[model samples]
Target: MIEVEHLSKRYGSAPAIKDVTFSVEKGEILGFLGPNGAGKTTTMRILTGYLPATSGTARIAGFDVHEDSMAVRKHIGYLPETPPLYPDMTVEGFLHFVARIKGVAAGDRANRVQSAIQRCNLQERRQTLIRKLSKGFRQRVGIAQAIVHDPPAIILDEPTVGLDPRQIIEVRNLIKSLAGEHTIILSTHILPEVSMTCNRVAIINRGEVVATNTPEELLQQLTEGTGYELEVEGNIVNLTTYLQRLAGVRGVEQLSNQYLPEHRHKLRISLEPGQDLGRNIAAIVVKSGLGLYEMRRVQASLEDVFLELTTEEKPIDAEKTIHTEPAVDSASPASDSVVEAAQTTPTTSPTLVPESTHPSGGEDA
Candidate 1:
């Protein structure tokens, strides 16, 4: 359970994120998405207590992140974009070290470490040094450490940044498995990750939350209605003129060249929302003596929603299922300063974060 209200952060006069707001229910995995310099990292930093917000409030498991920093840290497991790892330490050794630092009790450390290893599929590699492991294994090691102390909420930023396809799927499945037991806020630029892994999505652009809704709802909301793509042969001019006159047909655009005799001509027919123009279009093409090669509906996708929102100068009409959160200022011009700074700056090394809730770090393995 997490809630952020009217969150804003400013680097000097330039705003990194402004009036951003969203919530995640218990057992829900929320995907935080945005383009480069869209205040994603800034927002995450504020939530983690690594950086403070200029204004607004963030609470984790009912504890205020700003007012009760230490208590809030106790309930959250954080993995920055770069995982904090000691290269020389063995897998089991590193997890044991992290468990202790995260305040796992001495008696419970062994079980906690073992569970993390098993959950992250690090059982066989437990004896391998982190330096010797591949990037994928190293990422698994990073995730293992986050859950080692068994925190209720986990914050993972770019958990699968550079892994191969197989490894990506493995890590995706692993994150999915943690859903019911943990409340996760996954921040990544990868759209597929959000579509496949998250329960809901929050699309932030220019330091503001432009859209917040389920992936399905966002897709339908932002979709430019529906239409059909057709591959037809023979007299294209007559077919185009005929289809354009059909009821419910909004427009028609030719997608392929008609000059080539060997290839069939491709035409995209646009239709109003909720219109089924396939049956009527087919009859017209056949009646006019043109051979219809192929026809299929063009469904809306998440990538469509993402590009439209991020690229637009003004926020999309709020009436769409995906409305911009009212708290954020929608009229302000998007700031590119944050994006430029992130690109020019070098990334810092990762650190193993230890919470202060427990009496002390666990004993050494």
Candidate 2:
């Protein structure tokens, strides 16, 4: 359970996060997303009690982050973007050291350290010096340290930043496996990661949370209505111009990459969101002597939401589904429950996420 109320942070005249408020419920994974310098890490550090906000407050497990930082720290595990590794120490020794610092009982420290090493797939590297290990192993060591005390919640800052594809998946899978027993918050810039690993996402932009909602909700809210994507095989020039002229239509933007440089007869058209212009556009294209290859509504996606919420004054269709919470949510206020769950559980799986909760793929409970 976590609550961040009107959180703001500043370095002199420059602010990092401003008027940001959100919560994560027990057992849910809240994906923190943003571009570099978007204040993602700043918010995370505040939540984990690693950094104090210039103004505003954060609470962990019902304990105020600033007033009860020590108590809050006892309930949460934190791993920064760069793995904080002691190059001189072996993996086991480093983990042992972290366990003591985290206040793990001396009697159970060895077992807890071993369990962390095992769960993070660091068994083979347990005796190796942290500095000598590969980047991936070093990351695992960082994770091991975070979990050595078995805190109820884990906050991971850019967990996959420098890993290769395979290692990225490995780390993601490991995070996923900790569901139900350990609440986790994973921050990353990759949009697909939020869709794939989190139950909900909060996008921070320009030092403020420009948007906060499940991926799908944000997309729906951003879009004014439904739209279509078209691919034509011939005469795109006249056809595209014709489609732009139809009534109830907003505009048309062409986005295409020929399969090969030698290919030039095909075009991909993204219809601006508005009324039912697909049929009219279709008629015009066929009449123009161009063979239509494919025409279908482009459902709202995470990218749509990101673009719409981050920028202003872009026209959009109104038919998009942005009215209600995803069907899977069984909680009253989404922020409250999701935030609470973030302490004790990491969500079930890809399918368990609340329905209509994401831009495209579904999340598991």
Candidate 3:
């Protein structure tokens, strides 16, 4: 479980994330979506205890990320944009090393390493050196190290960034499999992956959270509902007026039928939220003596929602516009409230690795 509230982060006078807030329910995968420079990585770093918030608070498994950084780290497994890895170490050896560093019991290290290897589909590469592995395998090794300790929470930032298409699907499936057992926050630029892998999504723009809800709910909010496109042949002079009078009908627009045979017309009908009038439309067309050639349903997509929310020059008050489920407080399960502004604060913390060690090594913060 994870809870973040009124978290903000600023560098000098510039803020990277302002009043950003959202929660990941236990066993749920929340997609953290945003355009470039929208403070996604900033938020991830703060949650992982790799950075501290200037204000607000974030808790993982009931421990404050800032006040109890060590405990929070123990409860979370993080995979930064670049995975922390030891190029010279074999997949199993690196996992063992990570397990030790993450405080896994020495007696259980072998089992944990093997489990991580299998979970990440690294059986063949278990004995292969990380440097000798391909990019996909290296990525798997990164994930394996992150889960080697089996932490309850996982923070993955661009986990599938550079992998090939097949590799991307493999990683996506791997992430989905981890859901129900680990609370995950996945940040990526791939919209389709989010739609397929996430149970809910939080869209951020210009350092502020614009909307947070299920993908379907967000789509509904944007389109107000689905619509239909119809192709018919008949007297259409009063068709628009007749359809407009129907319950739940928002508007009807005639699409150009220049290429169609004479008397054939195309119409696009918009409907109010939660309304489905396909049957009624068909019945009316038949009763009116119109020959209905085609009828197709149209709905808003995640890409549409993302563009609509992020392209606005002004910040949107998520509570006032979008429908969001009550966020449960990890500290108090009975308390429910809408997610509000929470952002990361800029604070210096000790790096997870020493400068003398692998300089290119990623940090599993």
The number of the candidate with the highest lDDT is 1
Q: Write the per-residue lDDT of candidate 2 for residues 334-360, one digit (tens) a residue.
A: 323332332233222211001011111
lDDT of 1 by residue, 1-365 (tens): 89999999776676778899999999999999888778787778788888878899999999999999998888999987778999999999999999898889999999999999999999899999899999899999999988999989999988999999999999999999999899999998898999999999999998899999999888766767367878887756655655665666787776645454564777777677666656566766766577888887777777778888889664543121211223322232221222233233343332111000111121000
Q: Report lDDT per candidate.
A: 0.79, 0.71, 0.78
Better of 2 and 3 by TM-score: 3
Best by TM-score: 1
Clashing pairs in 1: 100-362
lDDT tens string, model 3, 160-272? 98899999999999999999989999987689889999999998887788899999778866644367888999876445545655666787767778788999988878777
What order do you get sorting by TM-score, best first? 1, 3, 2
* Per-model TM-score on C-alpha atoms: 0.82, 0.76, 0.77
What TM-score does model 2 achieve against the real structure? 0.76
Per-residue lDDT value at 52 in model 1 = 77
Ten residues in sequence with the least summed lDDT for candidate 2: 350-359
User: Which segments of model 3 are wrong by more than 4 Å?
Assistant: 220-222, 232-238, 254-266, 283-291, 313-365
**CA shift at 18, candidate 1, in angstroms?**
0.9
Q: State how far residue 221 of model 3 sits from its true place (Å).
A: 4.2
